[model samples]
Target: MATRCLRYGSLAFLVAQDTALVLLMRYSRSHATGEMYLASTAVCCMEVLKLCVCVGMLYAGEARGSISGLVNVFRREFLEKPSEVLRLAVPSFLYLLQNNLLYFALSNLRATPYKVTYNLKILTSALFSVTMLGQKLSKRKWLSLIALFVGVTVVQSDNHKSDSDAPHPETGLGYQTLGFLAVVAAAFTSGFCGVYQQKILQAGKTNMWVRNAQMGLTSVCLGVVSTIVKDRQAIQERGFFQGYTRLVWTVIIIQAVGGLNVAFILKYADNILKGFAAAFSTVASCVLEMAIMHFRPTATFLLGGALINVAAYCYNTPGRKDGNKLPR
Candidate 1:
């Protein structure tokens, strides 16, 4: 029962976190104005926050709240097996790249288009999983995935038509071409990192919390370097935390703690399930955005959402295995 709950709960949280984080970022970046916070700085802060949280979880869970115990764990995981950190760095750096690319992506694309294009990560993730993790996906699941992509695309097509016809002052709008490329690259990055992270987290040899710490530490170091390189002049002119607001902090916290949520999902579930959660989040976020703007969704949007719902059901039919045993 507990395992089942963990699996489903983690999946649910993925949907919630993805939906909320993107919405919060849209607001903080576009609607809120006082001096926009730098995306690079937020990335650094987010990694720092995740690192601290991972350390705390490690000390509590693996070390039993003892300093010496924690040290011993560090020696075991980091000192004796130093390569573990390097392994974690592979996913960390990919994830970092994905996050940075997303900032560029979102700045260029509007909300709905961004969500739809980002679904390409689902395809990339499945490809990586088959290659890296040896996971099988039956024909049915493949069809479901196809439906998911088609559905989201159809849903957004209506909105795109609406937007082009009448450009209401939309937030998060930028150069569409650049945004499309950035998001496409980010999708690939997300796929690669997600599968690799799942392979490590489910290895069962290391505590999940400790594994997170390894990745988080690496992310912090890299994120700081990235921030210094990208925001050096801006930091010098203003400060690291310049233009920060309560909403911005909220966005940072939501984005930062995403690591923990994803850790839970990857530990209990797998990459494909995470993709479903993300796909759902994209639809839900689009719906919420439409609600906020008081715009009624067109018929195509409803048809698209209904197709996604059907795809989700078909993908998770009871008593069915995920896929065939494809040759590795």
Candidate 2:
């Protein structure tokens, strides 16, 4: 009973943290800074933080024998059979592209619209699971996916209409188009990376924290290079971290913590739980945007959100006991 309560508590906290991270990303873009490089730098910092935490926990709890023994084992796994780590790290590095793209999308779109559109990842993940894991989906699952796509389309159409009425509508379209494309790419990459991670996890005895740390290291390396290449001009002009305020730092910390929580969730929960968390976070984001930003949701947006929620529930809920093996 206590264990179950703790799991539920962690799940709730994860949802809140995820919602806060999204809101903070939007706030950072709109208020403190618009530099994607700086944001990427924060993400690199997050990866480092996760690595350090994972190492600390491993040494404190999971490590056996002497410190030297643990060190030797680490050396053996990382040096001798590096391919095992690379198998997960490579896909993780690719996933960082999706994360960076999400930041770009959040900067361009309003929080509500962004959340609504991002829910499409659920469908993308299902498709990837079917193709990559040889999992089969039921007819009802396909219908739910279709419903989710339709709901997203409706919400996006409403957002476009709203954008057209605003001043400088032409500029809005340019940004919206870029943002939409980024989000689509992010969704596909997210699905593939998730399926790949699950495959790696099931294939070996590698520690979850170790895998996370390796992926973090890979992301930090790639993120540093990408940041330098992409933000050279901005860094030359304004210096790195220039325009960083307290709120910006808050966002960075939230992002780091969120990443760690995700690693934990991936280790402990199934993909359905992850999808449900993302959907719940979307609802929470809409509420947060309304309360914090004084944004009003359109009737169409609400209708779309309701449909998406229903679809998400239908898609994730188990139809039969045998279906539980799909996420594995």
> What are the TM-scores, per candidate, against the unseen true structure?
0.87, 0.87
lDDT of 1 by residue, 155-240 (tens): 65664433322211433355566767888899899999988888887776678888888888889999999889988999999999
Inter-residue clash pairs, candidate 2: none
Per-candidate local distance difference test: 0.76, 0.72
TM-score of 2: 0.87
User: lDDT: which candidate is best?
Assistant: 1
lDDT of 2 by residue, 1-328 (tens): 6545545666788789878888887766654324333656666666667767776766765566368765865686667877776775677677678878887787677777887888887888888878887778788888989999999888877754343223222123226767777788887787777777777765667787777766776777787888788777777887877666777678777777777766655655555566677888888898888898766888998999999999988877757643544333
Candidate 1 wrongly placed segments (more than 4 Å): 149-173, 294-309, 318-328
Query: What range of 10 consecutive residues in model 2 has the weakest lDDT sum?
Result: 164-173
* Model 2 alpha-carbon miss at residue 196, Å: 1.0
